[model samples]
Target: MGQAWRDWGGVIGVSACALPIVVALVVALSRWRQKRGVPARVAWWRSAAEIGAVAGTLPWIWMILTPGEGPRQVHLVPLRDLAAQAAGDPGTAVAQVGGNLLVFAALGFFAPIRVAALASPLRLAVLGAAGSIVAEVTQYALDLGRVSSVDDVLVNALGAMLAGLASRRWWQDDVTRPLCTS
Candidate 1:
């Protein structure tokens, strides 16, 4: 809906604006390292993935943590809030599900490629869940007027795990011999 899009306009705009800068910086850094007689082990995609992860995630986080006019809300029961939302507005429900899944997707997809220790679905899920928990706790603590629900955490972890699975082929091969040293 127009309202939903308008509400999320800032987040979308920020990510869109930062994308080109991130890519350019990544390219420049890659070139600089290569020119210094260092192997270009850090592929452009890796940099893009990392930068994109942060750029795409931060705006949503800001939106999440920003306090609204209303009082904060918490939903301790798993899926209760989600079910209610889905029943009320299917479109909103779908958008929420997709957004939650995507929150940590880039990190999940590219982290394993960059770090051997994180080259597993379980690790990615745990990491995503931990990050989601922190976000929820922050929302609750700050009285951000957002619903802190277990469903969000579960869905976010699921998204990360799925992303890890999607990148499994690359991770399995890359983990044995890391491409770049962080």
Candidate 2:
């Protein structure tokens, strides 16, 4: 936990400090939407979801893109790095797996609430995978001294799918059906 904080404390600190700005943005956007005739509940939720997604996601992205100490590594084999990590220290395993899972969790949790197209868990998984792929590729291209692993993608997608499932009740169901007469 101390080591984890050392690694992520700066990003976490900045995010915490920005909480007020995030809240203000959410409130401002909600008010604007309400003024535009949207229902208050819908406006508040949509605005909060949008702001929360960006606010929660950007810090993780910043951390992922930050350069590391080790040589740049690529582990294309699925589960290879995860197995190694799991076989090593338990704390490291949890942190690595947990961090990877959270890479897109915010987007998964909040995007569906704002966009009906992204309401499905499968879609969230795919989106998370795609986003992870981009991050991995970027890490390699930038020589960030990070391991680009397929397991990271898998875990990230799993996290997103799980988060999407958690937020399913709040998802925007835009489907409309004609009245049926019996």
Candidate 3:
């Protein structure tokens, strides 16, 4: 649970917030310089490809330091006492969801900025899975006080996909809509 929160919140969530801003900034600057309207940031599909590649691999980097099971970077919540009674408690679920979404979102957001070939959702899934796999495999290999879990990979991948979906339009057209649809 501790690790989940870290993976999701620390990594995924941070990425979600960060990547888009950077991508937008770059696109904005490019527009500022262009004499004609900034040419739609290389088409919608192109943006997707760019976003996917970057959105996919970030999880493996931090997995190295993650321990097997954790109270991990402890946050103060009064419910810590009842942790033993539940497997699907609200607190635990929140951690898992938040952490996974964050890191994956980060990947999604950064994908456009970090890599130029991430336009396809399928491709994004591939990279996202790859990142999760590497993290799990690395944990297994190093015996670095962590155990790899398929669930993490699945959640991470899903989160990234969601991020991609959220930015579907960003990948499709240079036309800005809502953050999720834009």
lDDT values, one for every candidate: 0.77, 0.87, 0.56
lDDT of 3: 0.56
- lDDT by residue for model 2 (1-182), tens: 79778988999999999999999999999999888777777778888888998898899999999999999999989888888998999988998999988989998898887878788888999989999999999999999999889999999999888888898877744311111334
Off by over 4 Å in 2: 172-182
Q: Please, what is the TM-score per model?
A: 0.86, 0.92, 0.52
Ranking the candidates on lDDT from highest down gives 2, 1, 3
RMSD of each: 2.6, 4.2, 9.6
* 121 Cα displacement, candidate 2 (Å): 1.4
lDDT digits (tens) for residues 1-182 of candidate 1: 79866777777787789878877887886677577554566555455556666765677677677676677777789989778878887887888898899877877877776676888788999988998999999999987788888999988888878887888887755323644545
Indicate the worst ten consecutive residues by lDDT in candidate 1.
Answer: 173-182
lDDT of 3 by residue, 36-69 (tens): 4434554443444444444444553563456655
Ranking by TM-score: 2, 1, 3
